[model samples]
Target chain A: MPAGASTRAGSILAKPDHRYAAVSILPSVLVVFAVVIYPLIYAVMMSFRDSRMGVLGGFIGLANYARLFSDVEFRLAIVRTLVLTVIAVALVIVISLGVAMVVNERFRGSSFIKLALLLPYALPGTLSALIWRWMYDPSYGILNAVLYHTGFIKEYVTFTGDPRTAMGAIILAHVWKFVPYSAFLFVAGLSSIPPGLYEAARIDGASSLTIFRKITLPLLAPAMQLALIVQTVFAVLYHFGLVYIITGGGPGRATTTLPWYVYSETFRFMQFGRGSAAAVVLALIMLVFIYVYLVALSPKERTVS
Target chain B: MRRQDTISGRRRRKAVWLALMTVLIGMYLLFPLVWMALSSFQDERVLQSRPPRVLLTPDIFTLDHYNFLLTGRMPETGIMVQAMYTMSGTYVLPSVVNSLVIAVTVTLGNLILGIPAAHAFARVRFRGNRTLFMALFATRLLPALSIVVPMFIIVSRIGLLDTKLALMVIYLAITLPFTLWLLRGYFAHVPRELEEAARVDGAGRFTVLWRIVLPVAKPGLIASAVFAFMLSYGEFPFALILTQSLASRTMPALMAGIGYYGSSRGMVAAASVLSFAPPLVLAALFRRQLIDGLTQRFE
Candidate 1:
């Protein structure tokens, strides 16, 4: 809210029944606290105990944390997750920038294109993964049929069935769902770049490329920051639904990200302590990411204007 | 004349390039869903054939998939687990109903909890206001996996597992904070003069808010409602954890269960289409509102 609007609104609505205000706010406050704070503390405690098969055992004190370092599967899962996150985030930002750039221009059928882009963002990750899984199906998938028909390969290729393509498959699906959101944000960012600057640059004989590099890019920093934050959360940090649907961390754990590892550890391996420990570590890692991203993107991220 | 021609030529090339890119982006985004929709109508054998037919013809397509989904009659899917999948296929509509109920309940929960809370945050000056707002939304920043273990245990201990109530409660928590964010932004911006005018006419606070504020805040309400609905509808992990069967399972969970068993590609595609319909419709209808709400701060 602008300061003017808020102040104006506040002036008339001053002390609008503080009791009513508190009563209304209390439900959301209580829910958030009870649901989040309690579970978070419990997760911390479970990380210390030797819980297996959903059974709580004696306290094990940092053993679960220590084990995260030495366990090769866990280590590999972290590495795979980082690789996927880094690559996916890069693609999401760049592609969304391209998308936003194009969509910002009022060309024929641009409105349709804009709506098309948002369709994927609106689709569920699991459903999106299922669609891609069909596309990647070895014998029956359209991808294989297309590649074979086009003479890209002599034989149909196994996408998710093969270790090499599984990571790429999930990444593609993940990126597909993620890019539109950032694209829409970037379109807003692009239009928000006052048109006068563009006219001025044009009069000054700046090339399109130069104008983009100079005026457009710097101005897009806020949207870029937002895209980065959202992508990191959905693409790398929290989203396991895509992987869960498409691969289930299979084909030799080729697509196993850390989030998947948490599910795998708890359910498949039945090591609740380790899974909780992994969860705790994942939270800590997320904190570091939030910290670094905020610190790096800071002040600018807050001020959209 | 040559300089003018050169500049015109450059502009033409740029326009063509943009046009090409626009079409490609459209195809890239829409292809998978379109393919899934078209493929669902194909015969199982036709769908499974090596270098499967991409286009549908009268000879190739069948309504068996739709028949099985819309009605309880089994399609002639030759899998040995026909009985199982048929039973499971019947679950799709019911699970969809489950999703609708839960999502609707979650949306209502969001509005009921969100409106007043957002109003307070934006208007009512209180101690710890900013702090509470931040803390409420803090969980959104982290992965659900972090706290899901304890949440899972808590749900089970309370014996709410495999129940829709568990999902409804969790989703309310998950969605309310974000709804609060959007609604607060909205309520803060509602014109105060109208409410004051109502007050001058001798209306109470609740009545003023009801009569004056709500109508003005309708856009915010719609946006928040749609946001909560979409999130609740598409949510996966908790649905996977909490729901045991069609009794409380959502569309995504049911689809996942089918995928796990390696169900027929044609039928799975059919299931995907059925499941995608609701959100797809919602997205198509509320695309403007959803986008505007999400990018509210952008302007």
Candidate 2:
């Protein structure tokens, strides 16, 4: 059978014109190869050699990897990245799910709320951090003002300056920026559930909570899993802008996630070999993340296949 | 009758609660943008006030920040004296134009390549199609940091660093995968019978795609276009690393350079609002297409 032949085509599967298809597909393949695949291979190779400021040095197999493991800061950065990723992903899921349910109710003004929800994510991440930076300003932040005026605080607090609240502040900005996208995912998930299922449950005298638990929660799992996995990847790899702008990964290295570590190591410290090695570790970690997602999705995928 | 009345009453209460919840969430989502807009309008001195002016009276609100950004003229009262000194002859507007250039060019590049490739993948099955599809999407799996060093080295070697062409090439990499995947779904959604009918009328492959399939897939095409635009417009990492000057630096990097409303808080706020205007407006107007494109099932 011709590969990927449509069902409409008869049993006499004619061979596809590979030349035509290849010609049509070559430009995109080449672009991606030059920009994405080639760079990736280069990065992997660079991880094996000692380089300084993009100049190649002698091949030092796994030396950078060894240093990455032994380095105290890199270890701490890994721990911090894991902590942030877990907490941020969890918060994003819960908050987005809750908001999705509310919006799915389709109450009056829901459309306006939907429009408003896209703002944070749509605005550039750097600017969102800046906006939140103003909101979180210690002496003159609107957040402090509102809290003090509302009698929730006794004094002005440095939200991003204190190590205790720095990462929390960053997480809050992240949630603000990311929740909309995840909420949209949940909304899509909710929309996909067959209305007949809910109607059937209601006809069977199911309570609202029972209907949700039995009919909604199980059905929403795929989208929920997708959102969680994607957000986890983002938390690990992205959020560099938030970390860079708000705290500069500062207040004593309080917010230096893995991406930030790569940035500072390679760009600031000019340790190209070490940075490339760290980047490889990050890529490996991400592979594990994707592998988990794949493993989780495999059963569903197999059923469909 | 009494039970019926009670059930309606319960629904009314639920609706009321939902409305309340939506209002609270909307405020949480909107207040930051509102604050930025307000700060942009207020005088720099007014912004520094303790408890910063929440409601703008006519007196505190002025267009000085915007005027300065637009005209390059400093206010006589010298509210942003320090900012003016630092930002004199700054190419804020030109830089934003550079951003537009990169975003528009990259978006067009993506669609041109993405549409044909997606059509090929969806319609013409060939050897290695599945493998190529997997590889194309796999490119997006790794973090941008993983390849930034190599990409930088590659771009600089070609001597395209800090040029819009450099940005176009890098952003093409960033946006093409998503565009290809989404447009492939769009192409697949076009009923096969439509193309076959056109072919029966003697239309060639390209003409069938161009005439019959594309018209039907226009909404999806627009959605993918918007997505491509926004990705390049708001992308930060590559923008930060690959470009160093106004020669090619986009809004995100430029805004970051302003130090998050540090000293020139007012001007930066204005620039932020200005920078966000196009994508935000596009997003608002095309909300439906964007949402459908994102949340639509490919399968």
Candidate 3:
């Protein structure tokens, strides 16, 4: 009976006291709430009301959102943003993977080449965009000059000026800026694979292509997913500098993305309410993507750790 | 002898392939930068000349554009007097100073605050830690555009508007989540046995952290600081909207205005090269640490 009572006491002692953990995490929680959560809530509240650049104009539930669907420019902006995000993310993944594979191979000056590739990412995005803007200038730009001299084309290509090439130019800029980052991540992922696994596969008569497809691809999924998610969020919200400098969402509004659209509304048009509403929608869409991505990943990557 | 010849031939073929690949990738990456540097020295007449010249020689160099920019004068409109007034009155120098001050301060601030937070999250597991850590990671996932307007209001209401402190605080908001998440991962990877051994030798928590954890996590800390500085330095929209005067503007914003108004392309290129200096220097100095910090996994 005494032994049984001792075991009962041990069971009681084993229960976790959560208060200490709560206190330790409290400060971080509060910081996040104040900076991230509070602003998020405020954004949502402002979206429902007619607020103008930090001033409370009035309450108008769903009216701003309704106006968004009705506005032709805003609708077009959504479509354009989706297309840009998809294409840019896809190209960045493919090109970066290709670069990573080459860099992973043992070669002379690989590190130097990798560093050069990452140079644009290290520089400020705004500055890089501005540099490219000069490079894309119609008459004096090096790009047009190169193409003209090479006879790649008979005339100077108005990359950012023409609607057909505007989105493509912006996408190229995004890819160039981010591919190095994705490549770096992939290289890290590749390094983690054990040589033993490859040896075992080779013993089984696996070809190089089959080995990559069967082993490397599965193992690198986590890194790829991480890159894709982060790049998607970044690409979706990739305004403020590049778009502001390169196209300013111009060439007849062909390049106006959701973030650029919000900027134009709040700063240019002074339509804060509508802009806030659009921001709300964009955030919600991003949240949905994150949610779906997490759910999709959980089962497949259960053993990631 | 026949076998040796075959092996040598194969080795030569492989060497050639590797060399070719490296050169192609190198050119692909470096051409734009090379072009920029070349154009910066070229004459304006040459810049406008048909069939533009890609090569730069000493004969093609000129300082006219550089002189124009430094004097705050536009050659097309004779607007030096007006431009100077704008530059001085708008606080361009102050803005650049403010950006540097805020970025440095925030980097230091996050280092101090973030290190402890990361330590606690990594080592001192108490309760609800997983959820709390997840919450911290979630903050980074939120869209910046969604929060910019609200953050503006928050900063304004707190009486921090138009101050470098405002930019610093906002930057901390944007950068802290990332710092905490990244450092926590780094800290978790640090073997706890070392800290435990130090503790057994009568070391306190702070001593154990300083001697054991800090030394091991040096690469991560340096990389995090570099990233923090980059974020704060390059941030434009927040700087543009939060701070009105030229005194509060950051370098990128200053460069933006320069690019928008400058007549000659050489000045813009010069400004671009100048603006890229700080980040490049930091990157080059801590390149190995930066690479390891970014590529290493800690889960």
lDDT of 1: 0.81
Q: Candidate order by TM-score, highest to lowest?
A: 2, 1, 3
Write candidate 3's Cα lDDT for A91-193 as tens digits: 9888877777777775776787677766766877777787778878887787888888888989888898899998888888777778877888888888888
Off by over 4 Å in 2: A1-17, A52-55, A302-305, B79-85, B260-262, B297-299
Q: How does chain A of candidate 2 score by TM-score against the true chain A?
A: 0.88
Model 1 ranges off by over 4 Å: A1-17, A300-305, B1-8, B76-86, B196-204, B260-262, B297-299
Two-way lDDT contest, 2 vs 3, winner: 2
**What residue pairs are clashing in model 2?**
none
lDDT tens digits by residue: candidate 1, A143-259: 888888898989977788689888998888889988888888898789888989999999999999999999999998888887888788787543588788777897898988888
Please say which candidate is ahead in lDDT: 1 or 2: 2
- Better structure of 1 and 3 per lDDT: 1
- Estimate, for each residue in B203-232, the C-alpha lDDT of model 1 and write its tens digit: 876677678777888878888898788888
- Candidate 2 positional error at A97, Å: 1.5
Chain A TM-score, prediction 3: 0.86
TM-score of chain B of each: 0.91, 0.94, 0.84
Q: Compared with the true structure, what per-residue lDDT tens digits does model 3 show for residues B94-209?
A: 44567678889989978877887777777875556667777777777676777777777788888877788877877787788788877887888889899889877878666777
Clash number for every model?
0, 0, 5
